[model samples]
Target: MATTSLVPSSADDPLAYRPIALVDLLDRVLGTGVVVTGDITISIADVDLVYLSLRALISSVGALTPPEPPGGAG
Candidate 1:
């Protein structure tokens, strides 16, 4: 008795397809990927906290003066 082959040897077969690389897959996913559009709503609390933190950080950083010129005041 002889066993029969389940899959035929052919390049067109589904199993013969080449595997995709992770980098290529990610590139396609991250670049020119799907675009989803919808309405988004956020509570005032979240927005207020983010804005306040950014304002404080910006103001503090802006207050810092540059070091004195190498030639003593430009």
Candidate 2:
């Protein structure tokens, strides 16, 4: 994210992320990349909608995890 700094892990360890905030990761990915716009052979107006919906769905459901706990000794 442009406004957020990367959180680092232990010194002896490799750069590990603690499951980066979904919004933050997306922001950084989008912001850092070069955005190029040109005349598309295919209709961009239609393609653009697919891109937008996919991004929205990813942000909404990507980071969530299941709440189940391990079952073993009782």
Candidate 3:
């Protein structure tokens, strides 16, 4: 009898399991820009007591800046 693996090995796939450092992850996230949204609710005896909603964009200054006008500066 023979057994087979369900997941591809890193050697078999170039895009497979590569570890990224925290700094690298942050750089990529900021470079591409990301949106985070969440909601929180607190209830007592099925009665809602508090609720919160949040939305945020995380990115680098360069990524958020708009491009200059078509022609160069006036």
Candidate 4:
């Protein structure tokens, strides 16, 4: 049997869509958040049967710290 990696490739990698850094995630979830609102409606036989709605708010980690100066405190 041929060996294969469990990690998804670039084409279908799920992690690729998710945040990889905690700080980055926090920053977006608290500072610059994203608001998502959606609704799905399904009907069969000319009658509505299924309906779905979703809403969420994501924020980033408030303010980010400034980078320190380089050159060992010149």
Which candidate's lDDT is highest?
3
Give the candidates in order of TM-score, highest first: 3, 4, 2, 1
Could you tell me how far off, in angstroms, the CA of residue 49 lies in candidate 3 after the best superposition? 1.6
Q: What lDDT tens digits, residue by residue, belong to model 4 across residues 1-74? A: 99997766777865565437997776656775688899998999989899999998765334344556886657
Alpha carbon lDDT of each predicted model:
0.51, 0.49, 0.92, 0.71
Q: Specify the poorest-scoring 10-residue window by lDDT in model 4.
A: 59-68
Higher-TM-score candidate among 1 and 3?
A: 3
| Cα error, candidate 2, residue 14 (Å) | 4.6
Off by over 4 Å in 3: 1-18, 69-71
lDDT (tens digit, per residue) of candidate 3 on 1-74: 99988787888898887789999999899998999999999999999999999999999999988888988788
Q: Write down the lDDT that model 4 would get.
A: 0.71
TM-score of 3: 0.65
Question: Which lDDT tens digits does candidate 2 get at residues 14-58?
Answer: 766557798887776554443334443434656543322112223
- Models ranked on lDDT: 3, 4, 1, 2
Residue 74 CA displacement from its true place in model 1, Å: 35
- For each candidate in turn, the TM-score is 0.24, 0.28, 0.65, 0.38
